[model samples]
Target: MNTDIILTCAVTGAGDTPPKNPNVPVTPRAIADDCVAAARAGASIAHVHVRDPETGAHRHDTAYFAEIVDRVRDSDTDIVLNFTAGGGGDLIPELIGTADDDRQIRAAAGSDLQTPSERHAPIGELLPEICTLDCGSLNFGNAVYLNTADWLREHAALVRDAGVKPELECFDLGHVWFARQLIDEGLIAGDPLFQLCLGIPWGAEADPATLLAMRDKLPVNAHWAAFAIGRMQMPMVAQAMIAGGHCRVGLEDNLYLSRGVKADNAELVAKAVDIIQALGGDVATPAATRETLGLRGAP
Candidate 1:
């Protein structure tokens, strides 16, 4: 165990969990407020994704993201701003039965299926301290999380050029392999930071053995965090800390703190902190995380 860990709160994600839990913050202000609360509760970093304030649909609007970042930066928080660069590659192929017809299947939805430049556009504009670069794609629920090798390489270079540190999000062991390839290609600078997503359907399962298995294959000298969806959230915090990786938690990944108990971002971070302390571990502060990740000035 590393004893020292960086704790992150993914405030609200782009997933379709809005209807299930009314507590998930969708507006920029709500998300920003949650980030501040999480920081005060012990989060060194806040992973952000903007949503359509009205419908609660996920959005990739730079302006909306900018508002959240600005609000958090101006408030009583010094949490590391980690913008989402994982949009634009969303390709929900239209189910227009036959390929011969220029007929459209389902129109492309979600921002992750975009081209490399489109994906990199917001990061260049917002220039947050850090951003996420999903190394590859997998089936996220019913949607095919989309990312190709070429696309990864292209966007990695752009993220590198933007002078923003990227926390590589790896949904599986192969994604970690691709993160290593990004390092080899010299597109990702600094000591690599990785987020191991667990218990996502069709991806890595949320279990001690599976977390350990995927973690064992991490690149040497890499800074990694592990997360499990729903009930596994806080449990994985201990698993990650004991295994020498950092931990991330929030409502985006889970809704309940316990049976019938709904949680906010602050509650999630608080739970992670308690677990870390119980394990005799220290949670990384924003300054400590910035130093450890070697984040450069944003573009």
Candidate 2:
């Protein structure tokens, strides 16, 4: 079992989950505050996704990202900020009838798609120490999360040129395969960092066997972490540490400290720290994590 662990807290996701929990951190200031709290609670990194303040909908506006980044940087607390560069790819399809009785498929009300450069805008401008590069597409709930191979190659090149580390987020085995291909193509620099995302609808399942299978498929020189959503979140943390990898936990992946107990980002991070200590492992600080992953440090 690996002893030293790099823990990440995904402060807020791009989902419509604010209504379900009041502590979801919608505004830029709230999200930045949560990131600082998570760092104090022992999180090495904070994975951030901004939402529209009024509507609580996910947005790709660089202004929102800038506000959050500024707040975090202005604070005295130190933590690695990982911005989400995986937005604007939601594709919810709908069929409509034409005047001539023909049918056509088009994006539905919830569909939000953008060109690669549009998606890369925030990362390119802000240039955080790390940003997410979702490896592949999958059936995400009722809609499809689309990320084609060509788009991925272009996105990878952009991240590499910016001198930022891309956290390869693999939702399935095929994603792991494609991530390896990106590494082989030399688009990914230094040691590759992977985040094995599990238990999200039609993606990889949350279980020890599934995690092990995906872990085995990773390149030997890769640095990786794993997380599972909902109730399996804490269980997977222990499993990841035991399997010789890092762990991630936050309101983005889970909202409850326990059954029927609501949790904020820092609480989830504290719980994960307790789990790491219980398993006889220590949590890695942001400085240590930067060294371990070869990050470019704070920007």
Query: TM-score of every model?
Result: 0.93, 0.97
Off by over 4 Å in 1: 97-112, 297-299
For model 1 the local lDDT of residue 282 reads: 87
Which candidate tops lDDT?
2
Summarize candidate 2's per-residue lDDT along 1-299 as a digit string, tens digits: 88899999999998888988999999999999999999999999999999998998988888988998888889988899999999989999999997656988899998999878888999999999999999999999999999999999999999999999999999999999999999999999999999999999999999999999999999999999999999999999999999999999998888899999999999999999999999999999898988898888522
lDDT of 1 at 17: 80
Residue pairs that clash (backbone atoms under 3 angstroms), model 2: none
RMSD, one per candidate, in order? 2.5, 1.6
Going through the candidates in order, what is the number of backbone clashes in each? 15, 0
Model 1 weakest 10-residue run by lDDT: 104-113
TM-score of 1: 0.93
Error of 2 at 299 (Å): 14
